[model samples]
Target: MQVLTINGQRRELDVDPDMPLLWAIRDVLELTGTKFGCGQALCGACTVMVDGMPARSCQTSVGDAAGKPIVTIEGVDGKVAQAVQAAWIKLDVPQCGYCQSGQIISAVGLLSQNRKPNDDEIDAAMSGNLCRCATYHRIRGAIHEAARMLEA
Candidate 1:
C-alpha cells in the first residue's frame, strides 16, 4: 500500500510503485481531470502541481510522488487558482477543452509564484503545454487577466 496526499486527501493506493502518477491519479484515484497527453512529458497535458511546482504526471512515478502534496485541477483552489479559473472563463480560453485542465494547472502554478508575468514569461512558462486548438493567444490573455485580477 502506498500513501499519497492528493488534493488534500490521504489516499492509500494499492498499486505498483512504477506506475505513473497519472494512472494513479486517473485510474486509481478516479480524478480524471489530469490528462494523459505525451507519456514522455513533452506535452504539458498531464501537468499537475507536485509540492507547489508544476510536474508532468505522465513522467512522475507514484513512488516519486509519495509523501508530496499533489494538486490536480479538481482540487486546485486558492486565490491564484480562483483567479485563473475566472480569467479562463471570462476570456473563453477553452476550445476543444481537452487540454484546458492541464493548462489551468500550469497557469495556477506559475501565478502562485509570480503574481505578475509578462508575455515572454508567460510564453516561456506555458511553452510545455500544447493546445491543439492553437489558443495560445487566448491562454496568454487569460493569464494576463488573471494577473490583473490578482492585483485588484
Candidate 2:
C-alpha cells in the first residue's frame, strides 16, 4: 500500500508505484475534478498542484508523488487561485468547462510566481493546456484580469 496526501487528506492506494498520478487521483481518490484530456501528457487537462507548483499528472508517477501534497482544482484556494477562478468566471472562458479546471490550475501556478505575466509568458505557461472550445483569447484576458485582481 502506498500513501498519498491529496486535497488535504491522507489515503492509501493499492496500485503500482509507476501508475500515473492521474489514475491515482481519479480512480483511487475518486476526485474527478482533475481531468484526463491526453493521457500522454500532451494536454494539460490533467494538471494538478504538486507542492504548490503545477505539474502534468498524466505523466507524473504515483510513487514519485508519495508523501507529497497534491492539490487538484478542488484543493486550490489561496487568493491567487480564487482570483483566477473568479476571473475565469467573469470572462466566461469555458464554453465546454471540461478544460477549465486545468486552465484555472495552470493560471494559479503562473500567478503565484509572476504577478504580471505578459502575452509571451502567458503563452509559455499555458502552452501545454488545450481547450477544445478555442477559448484562448478569453483565457489570455482572464489571466491578465486575474493578475490585476491579485495585485488589487
- Candidate 1 C-alpha lDDT tens digits along 93-129: 9989999998999999889989999999999999999
Q: Tens digit of lDDT per residue, candidate 2, span 1-152?
A: 88999889898999999999999999878899999998888889999999878999999999999999989988898899889989988988889899888999999999999999999999999999999989999999999999999888
**Per-prediction TM-score:** 0.98, 0.96
In angstroms, the error of model 2 at 136 is: 0.5
TM-score, structure 1 vs. true: 0.98
lDDT of each: 0.94, 0.92
Q: What's model 2's TM-score?
A: 0.96
Top-lDDT structure, candidate number: 1
